[model samples]
Target: MKAKMEHKEKKIKKVWRNMNIGFKSDLHEI
Candidate 1:
């Protein structure tokens, strides 16, 4: 059960990182 939670956290982290990058690029485009 603990392992499953860790895997989910990792996936969430990756998604958040991608979002941050996208936001940064969008700002640069302005």
Candidate 2:
């Protein structure tokens, strides 16, 4: 169970990082 939770947390962090990068690029486009 602990391992499963850690995997989920890592996936969430990766998604969040991608979102942050996308947001930065959008801002730069303006």
Cα lDDT of model 1 by residue, 1-30, tens digit: 999999999999999999999999999999
- Once fitted onto the true fold, the runs of candidate 2 whose alpha carbons sit more than 4 angstroms away are none
Which 10 consecutive residues of model 1 have the lowest summed lDDT?
1-10
Runs of candidate 1 exceeding 4 Å displacement: none
lDDT of 2 by residue, 1-30 (tens): 999999999999999999999999999999
Per-model TM-score on C-alpha atoms:
0.96, 0.97
The global C-alpha lDDT for each of the candidates, from Candidate 1 onward, is 1.00, 1.00
